[model samples]
Target: MRSFYGVVACLLLLQALLGANARAETDTAAAPPAEVLTLHEAQRRAIEGYPSLKAVGERVLQAGARVRQARSAWLPQVEASWTGSHTDLSDVDVESARRGARSALAASGATAGLPSTSVTGSIIRLRNLAGGAAALGGIPESVDSYRVSLGASYLLFNGFGRKHTTAVAKYGDRETRAARDEATRLLLQAVAQSYHAVQLFRERIRIAEADIAFNARLLKEAKLRNEAGAASLSEVLNFEVRSRAAEAALNNARNDYANARTALSVLMNMEDGTLPENVEVETLGVETEEQMSLPDGEAALQTAMASRPDLMRSQWAVKRAGATVGQRRAALYPSVAAFASRDASQGGNSRFGEDDFSTTVGLNVSYDIFTGGRNRAQIAEAKHAQKEAEYQEDEAALGVVSDVRQAVEDLSTAQKQLVLQRDNARYVEKNRDLVAQEYAAGQTSLALLNQSQRDLVEAEGNLALARVSLLAAWHTLRTATGETVKDWPLD
Candidate 1:
C-alpha cells in the first residue's frame, strides 16, 4: 500500500510541475506584442531617430556658438596672474673688507710685550669697530617677492570687422538650417521608397502563395486522373514538377519580403526584428482617383524656386560670402581699442609685502602699413567665392525646375501604367478562372492551365508594382516642392 501511495504522489507532483511550466511558457509567449507601423509613421520615426539628422542639429548649434563668439569681441576682456620667487641672499658679502682693515690696525698698534692688558684692549676695540662697519655697509636682500597684475581691453572699434564677421556667422547658421531641412526632405523620400518596397513584396508574396495552392490542386487532379487511367504517368510527373517550381517561387517571394522588412527596420533604427503582419499601405491607384490637386508643372517649378531649401541655402551662401568680402576689406583701415592695466608688486624683509603699485588706462590704435598684397588677395578670393555662390544659386534654380518637370512626367507615366496593369490583372484573372474550370473538366492541357495561372500571377504582381511606383512618384513631386512636415500624412 505504501508503495502504491508513493507512486501516486510522484505522479501528482510531476503533473503539477508540468502544468506550471506550461503556464509559464504561455505567459512568456504572450509578453511581447508586435508593433504596427504605417508608411507615414515609418517616415516620421526615421526622421526623428536618424543619426544624420542629429548631426545636422549639432552643426547648427556649433554655428550659433560661433556667432556668439564673434559678437563677444565687443565685450571687455579681463585677465589676471600671480607670480612668486625666492632668492638666496648669502652671497652678498659686506664684512670681508672691514674685517681685513681691523686685523691690520690691530697688528700695527700692538707694542712688543708692553702690557698684556693693553694688547687685549686694542684687539677687543678693533673687533667691535669691524662689527659696526659690517652692519652699516651691508644692504638687506629680500628672500621672497610676489607680483599680482590684472589687465583689461575693450574693442572700441575694429573698422567694423567684428560686425561683418558676426553677420557672416549668422548667414552661415541660416544656411546650415536650410541644409538640414533639405536633408530631412530627402530622408523622407527615401523612407517612402523603402516603405513602398515592403508593401510591394507583400503583394507579391500573396500572389506566390495563391500560385502554390493552385499548383497543388492541379497536381492532385493530375495524380487522380493518372490513377484512373485517364492521364499518363508522364503528365503526373509534369504536374509534380510544376508544383515544385511554384513552391520555389513562393520561397523566393518570402525571402524578398523579409529583406524588404529588414531594410525598413534599419531605416527606422529598430533593433527588434518583429513586424506586424496586418499593416496595410494606401493603394496609390485608389488614392489617385480621389484627387488631382497639384498645380501644373510650370507653377510647381516656380514654387520650387521660391521655397526650395537648397535654393535658399545657396542664397544665404552668397550673402555670407559678401559679408566675408567686407570683413577682408575692413583690414585696409586701422583698428582702435581701449585698454587698461594695473600691476602691484610686494618685496620686503623675508616675506612678501606690498611695496609698489601702478595703474594706467590708454587708447590703442594699430594698422598694418604693408601686407605684401595679402589683403588684396583675400578680398579677391572673397569676390570669387561670392560669384561662385551666385552661380550655384542659378544652377539650383534650374535643377529645381528640371526635377519638378521630371517628377511630373514620372507621375503621369506611373498613373497610366497602373491603369493598364489593373485592366490586365482583371482580364488574366478571368482567363485563369475559365482555364481552371476547363482543366477540371479534362478539356484543357496542363500546360495551358499552368500558363494561364502564371500569367495571372505576373499580372497581379505588375499591378502591385505599378501602384507603389505611382505613390513613389507622387512623393518625389511633393519632395521637390519643399512641402513642410506638417503637410505629411502623419496626424
Candidate 2:
C-alpha cells in the first residue's frame, strides 16, 4: 500500500512539471515582437507630423497667395452699375416759367421803343415765347430717369510699380519656401540627436546589466569558496558591495534611457511624450576608419555656402528688399489708365432702349506733385531695408562657414577617440578575464580583480560613448553642409 502511494506521488509531480512547461511555451508564443526605430525612420516621422514644420508650410502657402494678389494688378478691372431716380416737379415748372416771362418783359423796354411797328413786333414775340413756355410746363408733374452702364478700366502705366511688386511677391514666396526648408533641416538635426541619445543610453543599460551579471556570478562563487574556507568573508563582502553598486548604476542608466526616449518622443510629436517599451532603437554598427574619413574642409565650406537653406533664404530676402525699393520708387512718376464705358438711359420709365445708349472712352493721367515727402521717405526706408538684408546675408554666410569648420573639427576628434576607445576596451576586457582567472586560482588579490572589473566596465562604456559621438559628429557635419536637407527633400 505504501509503494502504491509513492508511485502515485511520482505521477502527480510529473503531471505538474508537464503543465508548467506547457504554460511557459504558451507565454513565450504570446509575447509581441519589438518595434524597431531606425534613425532615418525617426527623422521621417518628425518631418511628417511635427507641428512647427506644418506651420512653416502654411507660410509657404500664404506667400503663394500674395504672389497671385500682386499679379492681379496686371489684369483689367470691369464693373456694371444701374441707377434710377424720380424727381417731382409739382409747382416748380409753372413758377419758373412765370418768373422768366416777367424778367424778359422788364428787361426788353418795349414801351420806350422809338417806333410803333418795332414795339408791336417785340410785344408779339414776347407773348408767343410766354405761351410756348406755359404749354411746355403743363406736360408732366414728375420725371423718372434710369441709367444702366458697363465700364472697364486698364492700367496703362504705373511707373513699373506692378512689375516690381510682382517681383517682390515672387521673391517673398521663394524666401518663405527656403525658410520652410531651413525649418525642416533644423528639425531633422534635432531628431537625429535625440535618436542617437536614446541609442547611447540603451547601450549604457546593457553595459550596466552585464556589470550586474558579472558581479552576481563572482559573488556566488565567492560565497561557495567561503563555505569551503577557500575565500575570506571580506572577499564575499566585496562582491556583494559590487553587485549592489551595479544595481544602482543600472537604475541610473534606466532613468537616463527613459529621459532620452521622452526627448525623442517630443521631437517626433508623439501624443504621450514617451516611446513604448516595445519600441527599440536600432543598434549602431561598428564603423571602419575609411567610413569615418573627413571631407576636404574647403570643399565642405563651398558646399555649405551653396546649399544651406538659411543662406538661400537670406539671398532671397535681399532680392525681395531690392524689389521693394523699386516698388517704393514707382510713386515718383505719373500713373496712366484707359477707361471705356457703354451706357443706356431712358426718361419717365425704367426701360433702357437702344436709342438711349451712348459710348464713352478716355485716358486718365495722375501725378502726385507733392506728398509731404512721403514717397521719398518710403523709398529711403526701403533702401535701408535692402541694406539690412544684405548685412544679414553676410552674417548668414559667415555663420555657415563657422558651422562647417567646427563640424569638421568635431568629426576628426570623434574619429580619433573612437579608434582609441575600441583598442582600450579590447585590452581592458582581456585584462579583466585574466585577473578574474588569477583571483580564482589564488594568484591575485580581491582588490586587483575588483579593479580590473571596474576598468573593463569603464572601458566598455567609453567605447559605446565614442561610437555614438562619432555617429553624431557625422550627422552634424552633414547638417552643417546642408546635405541633410538635400538628402531629405520636403516635397
Point to the candidate with the largest TM-score: 2
Q: Give the TM-score of candidate 1.
A: 0.80
Deviating ranges (above 4 Å) for candidate 2: 1-21, 82-147, 344-351
Query: Each model's number of backbone clashes?
Result: 0, 0
Full-model lDDT for every candidate: 0.80, 0.91
Error of 1 at 65 (Å): 0.8
Predicted candidate 1 versus true structure: per-residue lDDT over 30-88, tens digit per residue = 86654556777888778778888879878888888998998888799999978888875
- lDDT for each residue of candidate 2 in 354-379, tens digit (9 for 90 to 100): 78789999999999999999999999
* Pairs of residues clashing in candidate 2: none
